[model samples]
Target: MQRVYISDTNIWIDFGQAGLLDALFELPFTFVSTDIVVDELNNPAPAGLLERGLVVETLAEEAVEQLFTLMAEHGNSSLADVSCYLIAKMQGLPLLTGDGRLRKQAAKDGVQVHGALWLLDQLVAHDIVTKAHAAAALQTMLDAGARLPPVDCAHRLAAWRT
Candidate 1:
């Protein structure tokens, strides 16, 4: 079964800035974005995101209330971030995020959360990307100002360098 995820802005930006957004399509996962996230992008209505088949979704009915509740709890987050969480939580789908706070909160609330590192790991595990290529992608993201999870930065960077 294919896993579906509501991807957040940072995750999108990370892949986009790395020029590896197409790599996401190679994975066995479907990604959906919110209107708010689209609006947050530097460009208006990015054609690439749509062309890549990312489903753009809008909050429906009770979802608005749930977004509000998420906002109330995770007040430090943006509307787009809360919206992503709402969609993932409501659909019981995993939330794709690189935001530390959101990841922590989502995990605490039992919402499945995934980050760029996880994405890289999946790509390597599935043989979609070689470890060398994934590591280079990680370096590319870092060079492009992506704030990756710091925990394994040194170790992963070293492994990739080899």
Candidate 2:
């Protein structure tokens, strides 16, 4: 995993709701979010995430112009995703997103992307979360309404306990 990541709202919610956001802090990397994305986190949790070392940042001044340019080009682009993309692009960091559209758009724009399942895998791999715990967290995320890992990752999530 990269030493720094710009996280999308969905992935943040998954970890936050699953009680696994702290696991991210155990990793060498730092997680960052734009103020805009933090607002979209819906309250309280963003404060907690920040308290737990998640870096909430504002877009660079130049990024405002760049963001406007991108929005002008891709009228349908999500502002949330664009904020994340801009921060990651400007900082040369990878983005963490569970949104497929955001992932695809980031790829098209040459920005690197990852998702929740990868974070779970890392947790298990690094012993931050045991496989059984990681499996349970996955189930928790699903139950809490995180529609991630593309349904295709069900098998991996299922096999975590074995």
What C-alpha lDDT, on a 0 to 100 scale, does residue 118 get in candidate 1? 85
Backbone clash pairs in model 2 (N, Cα, C under 3 Å; residues 3+ apart or in different chains), count: 0
**Residue 103 local lDDT, model 1:** 87
Model 1 bad stretches (over 4 Å)? 43-45
Model 2 TM: 0.86
Model 1, TM vs. native: 0.90
Alpha-carbon RMSD, each predicted model: 1.9, 2.4
Candidate 1 lDDT over 61-147, as tens digits, reads 777777777777886787799899878877888999987778888999899998888888888788888878888888888887888
Model 2 poorest ten-residue lDDT run:
72-81
Local lDDT at 71 for model 2: 66
lDDT of each: 0.83, 0.80
